[model samples]
Every structure is written in C-alpha cells, then in structure tokens.
Target: MRVSQSMKPENAAKKLGILLEAAPESFREGTVTRDELAALQADPPEWLATLRREGPHPKRVVAEKLGISNSGLARSGITDPLTTAEIKALLAAPPEWLVTERATQAAVRAEKVRVAERDKERAARGASDARRSGGGGV
Candidate 1:
C-alpha cells in the first residue's frame, strides 16, 4: 500500500505494527509521512520499544495468542497488551480460565470443521443426484 499523509492514525499504526494505544499521542494525532511510517516500521521510537517486547496486539490477535476469547481476556483482566512472556507463562501453566477458554476455542474450531464437512457432503450428494437424474445441464 502506498503510505501517504492522508492515512489515518489507525492505518499508520497497523502498518507500523504498533497498536494505536502504544503509539505516542503526537503520532496518534498527526498525519504520518511515508518516510516517517517506513522509519517507524523499521525502527519504532522508545515508547514503541515496549510494544516490540509485547505488542500492539489487538483483541483478536491477543485472544488467538492466548487461546482465549475476548471475554476471557476481560475476565482475566488482560485489558492491556501482553508480552510474549506473559502468553508463554499462561500456556506453560494453564489457569482455570485459560483452560476453559482453550476448550471453547477448540470447540468452536471443531464445529466449524464439522460444518464444512457437512456442507461438502451435501454438495457431493446434490451432484450425485443431479448426475443420476441425467439433468446435467441442458
């Protein structure tokens, strides 16, 4: 994407891989030059340095990393960005909430898989019935 001054703060933050909350107030307010954006991506400022250690992780990213849901993050009081270490610790020693959230995630994934398989089977059955009926297009 062509980085331009017209880009919004959120877009700039996404491009730089820093969270909007992690970026400085000035950065959040002003438009960024392409060069500035590139520089930020290449070498984030001191404030963003901590984001490097942890992240500008959004809710989805954080949840996926922690194997939890957005609500789970809230229940765990993880309202802020978490470092890789914190995520690792949670994984290494699963808490009740973490265990529960992981199960939920797993169940959601399994259901999606099952639904996809069922859809595929239905499609195949439809195709077979169409072939048997000899109605394979006029």
Candidate 2:
C-alpha cells in the first residue's frame, strides 16, 4: 500500500501568497496534494491568480516588500494584511512612522550582525587559548 503526499493548509497558504485565515474555508479545511499544489502554481485558479496579482498578502510578504520588519509593521499600527496597491502607495509617499521604522529595522539588523561577529571572535579566541594552554587532554 502506498500513502499519498499532502501539505498542510498553512504551508499551502504561504506558497499561495495569502494568509490562511483569509483563504476560503474549503481550502483551509483540507490538506493539499502535491499534484494539486503544482497544478495551482502552474495555472492558478481565479482566486489564486487574483491573490497573487493583487494581494491581501500575509504580514511576512508585506514586510518584505515594504523593506521593514513584521514588528515594524505592528509598531506602525498595521496589524492587518495589506494589498499590493496599499503597499505601493506607502512606498510612493512614506509617512514619518514608516521612515522611523525602516531606520530602526536597519539598526536592529546591524546590531544583530555586530553581536554575531563579536561572539564568533570570542569563540575563536577561546579555542586558540585552549590549544595554547594544552587544555584538551584530560
């Protein structure tokens, strides 16, 4: 006996460029077969095409296209998903909060990289010191 392959609804929604909660109830209720998913991607149905073309996209995608973090969106009072048009409008005429959030996100990313590099240097120094002190043998 062979089992069929299937993807969870949440993953399908992500691939489909929509929030799971925004997807149709029927789509949300069932697992998607690999073949079905492929077909959807190859020649999407009206709903899928509409969503991909003119999205009420998920927060992650929204943040990516907006060049900001998900938390930045929340801090700017954007708790709901945004359509492509809305995203474009904001990009064309960015508000003060958006500008501030973008800077904050950049600083946060820079700080993360700085911390990671510092930790890597510390680890390398520790390893070098251990070797020089002949500390490995018990």
Q: How does each model score on lDDT?
A: 0.78, 0.88
- Give the range of the ten consecutive residues with the poorest summed lDDT in model 2: 15-24
Over 13-71, each residue of candidate 2 has an lDDT whose tens digit, in order, gives 88877877767788899799888888988998888878777888999989988889988
The local lDDT score (0 to 100) that residue 8 gets in candidate 1 is 82
Per-residue lDDT of candidate 1, residues 1-138 (tens digit): 964556788887777656788667898896877778778778777877777567757665678788777887888777877666777887999889888878887898899999999999999999899999998577
For candidate 1, the per-residue lDDT at 109 reads 86
For each candidate, what TM-score against the reference?
A: 0.70, 0.77
Q: Runs in model 1 with CA error above 4 Å?
A: 1-5, 14-17, 24-26, 32-53, 136-138
lDDT over C-alpha atoms for residue 22 of model 2: 66
Worst ten in a row by lDDT for model 1: 52-61
